[model samples]
Target: MKTTSIRELKHDTTAVMAMVANGESVEIRRRNVPVAVISPIPAKSPIERPNFRGRLKEIYGDALLTVTGTDLISEDRGDR
Candidate 1:
């Protein structure tokens, strides 16, 4: 972190912004007292989340079939 007075910040705004752009934090001061700070926003991940169901079907060759809960229970009960 670097400290700069308000007067200096106003005069050297471009330089202060450059420091922030390069990932450095700049503390602004008023008459030698801390007042504000400037920093860069963190980078976000570029990866997109994949559709897992689609991926599963793709890898397993679309073996999925629809079956209801009642159907499952009847199948389990059998001739009992």
Candidate 2:
């Protein structure tokens, strides 16, 4: 971790960014107190749709349908 003042960061924006690009984490301080951090962007995983029903089954088993009684869409629509 590298510590830098806000003024230094402002003065040497490219250099600070270079350090971050090199995978170094920077601690930015304001008035001698730590205020923020700059770090390298993480590699992203392939996006996938979350399985909401599977997650609900894992958490509540068969009780989910029984507990909710009505489908979420119907419940949200009320007595239309």
lDDT of each: 0.89, 0.92
Count of residue pairs whose backbone atoms collide, per candidate: 0, 0
* Model 1 bad stretches (over 4 Å): 51-80
In order of appearance, the predictions have TM-scores of 0.62, 0.54
Worst 10 residues of 2 by lDDT: 64-73
Candidate 2 residue lDDT tens string, 1-80: 99999999989999999999999999999998999999999979999999999998999888735545467778889898
Residue-level lDDT of model 1, residues 1-80, one tens digit each, is 98888888889899999999999999998978889998899999899978998888888785755887899999999999
All candidates: CA RMSD in angstroms?
A: 7.3, 8.7
- How big is the positional error of residue 71 in model 1, measured in Å on the Cα after superposition? 32
